[model samples]
Target: MLTTLIYRSHICEHFPPHDLKEMVNAANLKNGQADVTGILLFNGVHFFQLLEGPEESVFNIYQRICEDSRHYNVVEVFCDFAPHRRFGKAGMELFDLREYEREEVLQSVLNRGTSKYQLIYDDRALQFFRTFVEATEKENYFEIPPADSWAFVSDDNSVQSASLPAEITTECSFAFQPIVDPLAQKTVSLEALIRTSSGEGSAAFFSGLEGDEVYKADLKSKKTAFALAGAINVGARTLSINLLPMTLVRIPEAVNFLLEEIEVNGLVPEQIIVEFTENEVISRLEEFTSAVRQLKAAGIRVAIDHFGGGFAGLSLLAQFQPERIKINRELIRDVHKSGPRQAIVRAIIQCCASLEIMVSAVGVEKPEEWMWLESAGVSHFQGHLFAAPAFEGIPAVCWPEMLSAM
Candidate 1:
């Protein structure tokens, strides 16, 4: 099988530049013997390389390269199988970006490609080259420490019983997970995640419901969420609850119901945020927009949950701007190591920033993921890395003792 691997890394500080020539010569000789061919680009401070050859040979060569002490913050940005090589002639070629002007560097690199036709047609690989040569994505490259640098400690000892009305108490329960600013060491909000009374997920809780009943139940569950938040006395801290978009349209006076519930539970409208998933289609757009206005007028904020996971993202952003957007887990997963994901997320952050909308990342499970998102200007985060959702209670969060001095 043929394999192609593309990775980038930062050159170690105080490293001698003269040794780069000797290192390239050794790599060329070794790779030639192993029947591997690739090109490496160095832009004074960072190295981008692509290796394409037999799967076993390329894998072995990459392992050796990773162990070299000359570079740090290694991120394997792309890996895939291809029918043929793009640079079949050279064992390993080095291009120092410092020697070439930015205007001609990409074309110069393409001039070295053995498969010029493939490079022109395959924009994926070519875009990576262009991005590296232009250095447009340099700002998003965050160097995170080893995963074990910090530990995640879960403290469920402070758990308090989530009191629910007797009628709906047996029907469902709530699990509260915090959205926190790790650097600030503060909880921005606690999201009330719906679950079965025995602690099953939302899927199990709504399995038997159908049609408008699902929307009704989705709206009704918030009453229990509010009661639980009040039970825990989430004073001053924002409480975020998920809601179906249609619930606001289908249920009469839905915003008024929410406002009344907020008062009854000893909470205020400003402290509540209603999150509507972007993936769900809002069948009645006009009505939904009006309801959103009502929500805002009542001092309750609106947010688009799972922002990038669906088709309605840009259109929804244009329709009625939400106060916040939670970048979906799919985009957040492995973002630190992915050039494409990093670019997309950076665009999302920029767009939201311009409109004065806050962006948060959800389902972030790795320290690397959190680091990248934090560096990209997202301050709020939710996921198991800090604290898992507590069943019928609030889970205590574990903050990193020391962040990397980047």
Candidate 2:
């Protein structure tokens, strides 16, 4: 992204052609020498240019432009990446003032003799500019610039050179979502199963089940419950509730009902792990952390779900001090191929370990993956290859029975 500030006052219909020529020559020389290509749009009273090239070269040209006395009231209007050079050709092109009809109101404001560009300081003006540009692009009056194709290639090359394997999409299954204790070789009591719908009404489409449902068969079925009763009826002692950040902010009274039910059902506070998506949690760090801390004070365990992926922030995780961290499947899928990712996971585990916090690896389907995670000092594993999330209640049967059945 490159931005050049141009003095709006210097622009005039009767401005010296020689001065304009000098400015154009300087801009062209800089662009040519640095291999920077961009577009220039000049109205009778203002100039806006989009430049793209090596960061240093662009900055150097901008500095030179700032020192020129022919221009004043310089301001940067637009700046960002483009797919290809919109102004690939050499030389500056002056457009008729009518060409920028959309900016007429801004021009009027600037013509009023305002010392500062109102477009920069006025919120309404800023919004108008954004809207106008968007509308222009949508109407096809102006082509929306394409992002630099080299951007993705450079990113891919960097990842490749670091020996990180390309991301591979794997067929995920909900069959084995149970959390099993390896040492006891037993399905852990009060196991919390993470569930997601599939097909047309899948979470990817319709999202998880929500709303008030009467629980006719639970320990406290008559109570007005907030959770999806269907999961509870199936005998899940500890329910992992997936919450959006907004929902956490205005915690509904129904949540209190759910907590009441947990207590009535003889479930431990530690049994209930409120799983928060990475993006949702970190975005509203202060609010989410405050809510989590409040819940923790009440004896409920808070686990950050899908950690180290999406909008995951290590700093936020440390500050929040969640009870457990669930590692995303992406990092675990090919830890062997990506040393940096593996190192990241190891670092996270070490940090969590030092804080006495537990770590679980999600989407661990292969034996090799499990072995690698175990070697990495990960404590808990969940995915298919172990046992699917059961609709059945806590089995009267023990680990041996479950293993034999598997």
Candidate 3:
């Protein structure tokens, strides 16, 4: 299968057009030899590159690029096992902004699929791409005019990033969604979900970030979740924070910041749950495992989000026995009618039970689905049936009337 990786990095210094082209030419010859393909877009400041090929070839090339020292603060924004290559075997087709029309290149970026870009780059991301292309065409690369942006200007701290406006109170906010333990007749935790104060979806809310902007945004989100959880009086309830595995590897000290926030909020580290996507690719599990150990040592727990998706299967569970595993929505949706889905959920529940790991079913939209999961041994649940995400403070749960009193 073809695996694709999209990475964004900061260019350490300016390279002349001829030097850049030479670099691209050499890369083209090298990648072509290995059947690797992708586009590299640079604005003399930030860069976005997409690489796709046989899994090993892509991984090998990415490692070589990472160690090359031409750039620093490299971050993997997107990666997946693609059904097929998108820009197959380009070797290294440099999207030299100088040669391409500014508007045309920007439009191509805007028109890219959400499934590929939305989760990584934000809506305004195209605008940055356009601006870079414009700068290249005008031969004004070194002088990218600064604007009011919530991007980190430096890497002085452990997160290696800091935002321009240290106090950005307007762009986004945290919304709490309840995760309930139906059998216990209580809320197991409140997962902090992101909501744009302007009331836009995630894609628009997260738009226009590149390079250190990515790290700055993630750090901001972590701090915001804890602060909001405090304001809403999470108190004794478990508070869950969504983190990207990639970000954790980049900013492992983020856990210390989280620890500080918990104390500042009069909360204990034990009440905190560090949730991460199970499907997200990690090139270095050694780094991730170290971070997880740090969290565990600090008394914070971990949960594998979207448990049934990605390359990880039972092997991952056997390797890392996280305190909890969330049943992916694909297995919970309409599980009452789908025999295969039911079987998968049962096996997961039974397997987790044997391992003494708690299982929480996510995206349970109907009572039948809940009923099925509950019968299969999922005591904790999250989804619309309990309550839709409250975009502001904690709204009341629309729990079953019979259990609301209990």
Where does model 2 exceed 4 Å of error?
Answer: 1-176, 189-239, 252-255, 392-406
Off by over 4 Å in 3: 1-168, 281-283, 401-406
**Model 1 CA lDDT for position 130:** 81
Full-model lDDT, candidate 2: 0.49
Could you say which candidate leads in lDDT? 1
Clashing pairs in 3: 122-207, 123-207, 125-208, 152-162
Task: Give the Å error, residue 73, model 1.
Answer: 2.9
Best-performing candidate as measured by TM-score: 1
Give TM-scores for every candidate, taking all chains together and pairing residue i with residue i: 0.85, 0.46, 0.57
What are the clash counts of all predictions, listed in order?
0, 9, 4
lDDT of 3 by residue, 1-406 (tens): 7887776666656545457778899999988988888778876566778788889988899898877667754555456786655556468677655555655766564344333552334433333344444554232111211112112121121111122223326877767778987656577888888767665656766689776666567667766667767666777989888876767678757778878877876789999898888876234667788888888999999999999876787677876888998888887876654435655777788899999999998898876677656656678999877766765566566544332222
Sorted by TM-score (best first), the order is: 1, 3, 2
Residue 93 of model 1 has an lDDT of: 95
Model 3 RMSD in Å is 22.6
Better model by TM-score, 2 or 3? 3
lDDT, candidate 2, 1-406, per-residue tens? 4332221223433456447656676777767888765544454544545555666777677666655555543433344443344345543443334445664744542333223433454443334333433333222111111112111111111101122112111211111134555535544323333222231211432233243211111112212121222223424434454455545555544346556766664554556767777877777778767766666766777777788888555776656777778888888884533334656788888888898888888777655456556667875777654543432222222121212222
Q: In candidate 2, how many Å is residue 289 off?
A: 2.1
